[model samples]
Target: MNQNVQQAAAPGLGIEVSSKVPMHWYNLNADFPEPMPPALDPATDEPVRPADLEPLFAKSLIAQEFSSERYIEIPQPVREVYSLWRPSPLRRAVRLERALGTGARIYYKYEGVSPCGSHKPNSSVPQAYFNKIEGIERLTTETGAGQWGASLAFACALFGMGSETWQVRSSYEQKPYRRLQMGVYGSQCHPSPSELTESGRRLRGQFPDTTGSLGMAISEAVEVAAKDPRTHYALGSVLNHVMIHQSVIGLELLDQLEEAGEEQADVVFACAGGGSNAAGMMFPLLGQNLRGGSTTRLVAVEPAACPSMTEGEYRYDFGDVAGMTPKLMMYTLGADFVPPAIHAGGLRYHGMSPMVSHAVHLGLIDPIAVDQERSFEAGVAFARTEGIIPAPESTHAIAGALDHVTSGAARPGEVVVIGVSGSGVLDLAAYDGRF
Candidate 1:
């Protein structure tokens, strides 16, 4: 058995601990397949092999690497800023186990305590760090649930830079706490398809009550960022670098589990929107798999309303709310598609992360989609059991765990790890309607 497994099986103090594994940048090209073309546009459809993305790929954060002793050092200032929230906690979910009435051991690596109240800051801090190091003075990005906006705002503030965020319209109206959170972090947030940009104005003109989409917000943010040299666009997910940055979560979890005296996880579950959180939690485990260790099932849970990984075609697609950004190969429903107005607004995107899409295609992971009602049911159950009201986005994963437990799919002594990516304190309104 691997050291992790051995430690997990050993008896002693139940505190989890992680090995000091040296951090390294993963080779994106080696792990992922060649990019494909967008499926929605046939006239412009064409293959987008990894070679074709050389220019864009070169700009990836992983592509720029340095080492300072144990940590593969990113550029300065960004690294310095990241020190503020570098190490997040990997927690044991004993509360969840008592609620499940199952013999399986369960743990959750909580990512809600970060400045932005989600795992988003894991990437946002790095993105802003790099942009500032590159002499950029302003950052622009789009937000669905406002977690990303708040994270970026916090990062920009740490780096003495300015940030502007385009919030999805439905989310802006439905999740006021998200906007308030972003505003607290010093980001200027505006509802997407607002009167601020021509695209927003035109979009509102067509769909007045349009609960904005990620694609539309991306179009506006990218337009604004690309227009000025001082401003650079930042993405919350859907890129290899973002996933790479998020590996810290898994790194910490690996240690935490060891401290908890548990063997390797039998199953690892996470909710995937653009796939950053799931990828982060899975990357270190992927390293274990590559080492010819015991196979631990990796699962990605998403909403049925926007089941990009489960139902969408693996093809090139636009990464924006309005289909205005450069197209990339990924698993996508459609760039023009609009998801249901679910409380998990962050998971409403029409596409999966390219790396996640590639991983799913290669059978490295499994995808499951649950509906809003069911997800909320899971979230409420988790709250009652775990005592942490999960964000709607994370409830999808909790629901999946509940399914496994209630169905008796997990055996006694088996272990399951779920990524509780955020807290649902901002989602009290969602709970008000649930009961």
Candidate 2:
């Protein structure tokens, strides 16, 4: 190693490298012990065929949604774009461990370095690419907390395609900067429950004064895309393809851990909303565990206010309020349930990802929920020690890790990994009364 490399490799500072980006995305379905329940067509109460998804998604994404391939090659164009921010650093949280006074070794994969300051871009770029290649002129989608909207807008801008988003009313009001970010990326943004679509108008009439939900926003976006042949919908999470695209995170982390000389992680913690972040960061490791190559415990942390995995029932439910999308089999707290307006807006969804739900059902994933106050407390502590303010959604994982340590559940010297899905730079308002 060079002089600077030798210094960086010194014990206790955590390892950071930039050359370990994965060339392929690992598909968890290939390693799943059983076939996940297929998405159901609401009209027929039968399995949804790829043809049924034709109006919303590009052909390439639809193929990936149904694919059983173990590893999908990342396209050269997509990889070229990813090179700008791929291989995000995995840092040992020495300061955080010291603050907690715990012997357990904590590490975090920091994904805030991306252009959108979140992991959403991992999938958004590819989603845009696939749509552009298929001659789609514009993409429409929903957002909660605006990360996904900004990400898709950024990706669309890169591909020279137009984009539009319907953001949940709560986040649109709370995070105005996110909408500005989207606009800067050359996309149009609207608040959910606007009068533009029938779904939005109906929702507005039904709940006039209420804070909107991700489900509601999804209904509006889906309605718009279904009506326009030149436009396609790009979902940020809760599907097979999104999770597969996110696998780059876990794939890169695994390589980084080996390079940093860690044998294996005892547990991996990641905040789960629609489940893309957790799935992207844990699926590769979980696949190894399923195949008997590793024994890492995969933990999906969620907001207690909308604890789908922890408190919901596993059943077929609509992914959106208006039921415009297919009924997916997963852990759900009713399609229309509106969670309390918490700072972690990104995690206020009513259902979990089907793959994550299946993994939880089979006991492959341990799901946990953290309340708002405790999560914010953990985020503050981590920021004070590590010098990076975590996104409200990412705080759930920090809280989960702290819970494991403070509760004496983590063994001394055990290796723990957390996925810091994003930065809270633009979310400073969320911390106004939080601290």
Candidate 3:
């Protein structure tokens, strides 16, 4: 490796951005005991071909989807964009530790400092750049809590491209500022179940009074992209390429923990919304557990209202409610399941990521479901102590971490890391009613 690459990949250099981010993104597909099941053709029930996916994704990303290669190099352009928040701060939550009256050391990787106020930009920028190079003029995507929509909006603006997003109905209503944030970044945002796409129309007909889910929004987004030759679909989570882009979170986090003079974390917590950020934060640590035999525990926390991990069936299911996309093998609570209203609208998806589901099947992550009240309690506690209000989705992780800490899953003096994935600045409405 070159001196620059070595320094960038070195452990204990967490305080500053690596002069250069690591060249390659890690892919777990090649390392799994058996290959992850392929996305199947909805019509033929056969594995989808690369060309079949070309209609929706950039050619380069389609290659990354099923790649068995251990590492795929991050494009220089993407790395340059990531430089803006490449090394997000990892702080020891000393006050929260004292407040909990626990002897366990608490540390959190704060991704809220990013321009988009979340880890979504870590992938969105790259997706936009790849599409920009591929001559795509417009991108369509779905979002739940507006984080992904805002992130993609910012990315498209930076790349001089047009962006369209269909946000879940519940989130759109609960977080109007998030939709406005997308508009601020020069993107059009619509509530899912709007009269824009066939899937949305069908959903309105089927359940006139129901709030939309991510699956429904995804179908709407995909419908528009499939019809427009110049538009390619972008997904914020649940896809392999997105996970690859998000690995930057875990990579920097490992270095940060090492630099903090904490050699290991006994347990790590991240909220699982289609499992993007959590998988991103835990993938590298999972490798250590599998290959290097590390003892750290990985946890995936989800809202009880949409507990795809803890209660869903592990089976082949469509990513969208309309079943427009290829069928993936993952933990799913049925595409037709309409989750109850919850503040963490982002976690109201019907299925988890196929890769993450495989890990859970292989016993890599412990999935837990928490209620809104418990998550809010934790979020309030975290905000009061840490001075940064966490998004409702992130509070699931806080609840999970505290559950582990109090239940004695993590012993005294043991290190614990929680993935504080986003800032809830745009979600103050969800907090106001509670407080």
Leading candidate by TM-score: 2
lDDT of 1 by residue, 337-433 (tens): 8887777988988988876787788888899998889989989988887688888899998888889878989999888988889988887787777
Question: Alpha-carbon error at 54 in model 2, in Å?
Answer: 0.9
Q: Write down the RMSD of candidate 2 (Cα, Å).
A: 6.9
lDDT of each: 0.75, 0.92, 0.87
Ranking by lDDT: 2, 3, 1
When 2 and 3 are scored with TM-score, the better candidate is 2
For model 3 the TM-score comes to 0.94
Q: What is the TM-score of each candidate against the true structure?
A: 0.86, 0.95, 0.94
Clashing pairs in 2: none
lDDT of 3 by residue, 264-383 (tens): 778899999788899889987887777775788999999998989899999999999898999999999998887876778778889999999999998888898888898998899899
